[model samples]
Target chain A: MSDADFSLWVYLSRTPLLWLTVTLLAYVAADRLSAALGRHPLANPILIAVLLAAGMLAATGTPYRTYFEGAQFVHFLIGPATVALAVPLHRHRRTVWRAILPMGAALLAGSLAAMLSALLIARAFGMPETVLASLAPKSVTAGVAMGIAGSLGGDPALAAVLVILTGAIGAVTVTPLMNALRLRDYRARGFAAGLAAHGIGTARAFHVDFMAGTFAGIALALNALVSAVLAPVVLRALL
Target chain B: MRGLGGTILANLPRMIPGAALILLCQLAGEAIAHGTGWPLPGPVLGMMFLLLLLLGNDLLPEPLPTPSVTGAADGILANLSLLFIPAGVGIVGKLDVLAQYGLGLAVALVASTLIGLAVTALVFAGVARLVGRDGEAEDAA
Candidate 1:
């Protein structure tokens, strides 16, 4: 019995399953906590869940690889989820058509402005080159952001963190800022979310309405495409 | 119960391609990355390859699966909340990183989002105007 308990502890301490379970429970708790806090930007669930998980891992000294092993099942679903976005895009074909030009412009202007503004501001603050590289791809999706960051000599892992942070903050602030600006149209709202936040924004846009959600998906994919094509060319000019 | 079971059984074949296309892309992406020594992220490469395939070919496999009526596709998209679980969990592994760059990250997000929004609004507006009359013509036709 003692041997079994020892083995179980060993497994729990080293295996990814424990971390995965901890992540799930912490995520749920964070969601509840966010809701109870009236969904404040400061109480963002992703932010909280990440903090909670990180703390636990640090305390337990559990390697990230073990945790990732158990968590990858969830990661594998991302592809299907992305492909599934086509459904909403198909449904909102009219909106897409109407906004195609504006969307493209937005992506270009957005990407450039984002990269330039971040570097400018970071420079003003005397931030390091690493921070500049890390923040360059903050608005694009993780897949693209990591690539840009890596190519530019930034850390991919750091870039991933920056990307998520960008999305979470965007998700939190988009609605209120839009409302303040009196941007009532779902099309604009969704596009803004997708362009700015990537998938997280798309997910958040769905909460607003179907049109918004669909537009966000289109925006997300479009921005990714635009960024991929433009980042190298534009980034050369900036850096 | 019988109807539900029948419906599921009927749709299994159709659903396979959607899954297959994505998986195939992942595999091909991995292969291309290995072959070419491309520095692009594997999944990003996969997405690009799949996008090309989708655009270039009409010949998907035989007995073309009926495009989902609603359930399967809708079920996945609608559950995007859940879909983010893994990524979110992964984020948990990096909290110290988050804390270290919190404010700077926040500034970047806001700045980028605002720019993206302004640009999107402008581009979309211009496109809509150009396409607006054509859409009407199409409708009239």
Candidate 2:
């Protein structure tokens, strides 16, 4: 409010450190809160952090681009973290290898279902071509989904948002849905969540159990691979 | 001065090899995808590459020292969800598009996701049963 205070705000906001610190602190707080709440899927730390960061940015009138400048460091780690998924897959090699047939079948079926259902529902609603394209890869991880969306003439940014929402929705609904279906297998549960929700879902699976988390990671990678190849081809034929 | 700051600085040098290995794999993946014009993302390919490297190491006469690799990878995986927050916040920027197509998008997302999850689980369960794997029972034990 005061002139000195206003000057300080401008200087602080201009630095990359502000957003970086904010993102880290917000996520840490959300992680603790999620833990305190017993890691319920609805209390997803990423979801909470996103809300908190977005709210802070909006309240301070800081542009998303400015916030991203600092936050991109965290984003850059996704690549390395993705590569790290290989560690778990390596650990669970025998299980994955033995179930290769079932996993493959599920991947193909799930990928097609994800693409077709989105395309049909969006088409039925008479959404635009771009929106339809964006929705096609909604079940894949954000990075791969966005790429697929872009190639299919969809809005990549919208695809990213849709991917996040799908992950959140999948995380929240998976436990109840699986329980309702009497699905007790961690492999089945984790794979289903990964196929439906991608990274966030995989994270939720990990929280549930170590074996589940391992399969979820496997599913996340394979689903991304399968969907990337299938989405554009299917969209071409359908749209 | 010799406390938190020095300890972190001391650890910094040790973290580089692990971080570098990950980055190198990612770069190789990017290069391969770029060269082959594959539809896959570099990181995804990079993951496959890392898997192959690990597999290859499995057959070696003497395994390579990879403390840094495990350290870096574990550190990153431990907080993997944090990486998603940046892009997630970009949702705030797309409010207009969301406002326009919020209903359609919501319907499609929720419906397709549920369908995908259900179908995948049923199919997997069925196949596992046929194979007599009883993955659920195995996991429970």
| Clashing residue pairs in candidate 2 (N, C-alpha, C atoms within 3 angstroms) | none
Standalone chain B TM-score for every prediction: 0.58, 0.83
Looking at model 2, give its docking quality level: medium
What is the TM-score, restricted to chain A, for candidate 1? 0.87
- DockQ metric for all predictions: 0.32, 0.66
Once fitted onto the true fold, the runs of candidate 2 whose alpha carbons sit more than 4 angstroms away are B1-13, B136-141
RMSD of each: 5.2, 3.2
Instruction: Give the per-residue lDDT of model 1 (tens digit) for A52-153.
Output: 777777786767777777666665666656555555555455556655666666667666776677667666655677767767777777756777787777
Worst 10 residues of 2 chain A by lDDT: A94-103
What is the lDDT, from 0 to 100, of the residue A19 in candidate 2? 95
What TM-score would you give candidate 1 relative to the actual structure?
Answer: 0.77
Window of ten residues with lowest summed lDDT in model 1 chain A: A83-92
Best by DockQ: 2
- Over A1-239, each residue of candidate 2 has an lDDT whose tens digit, in order, gives 99999999999998889999999999989988998999987899989999999999999999989998898888778778888898888877877777777788887888788779888988888888988888888888887888889988999988988899999999999999999999888888888888888989988898888777777888888888888888878888877
Question: In terms of TM-score, which candidate is strongest?
Answer: 2
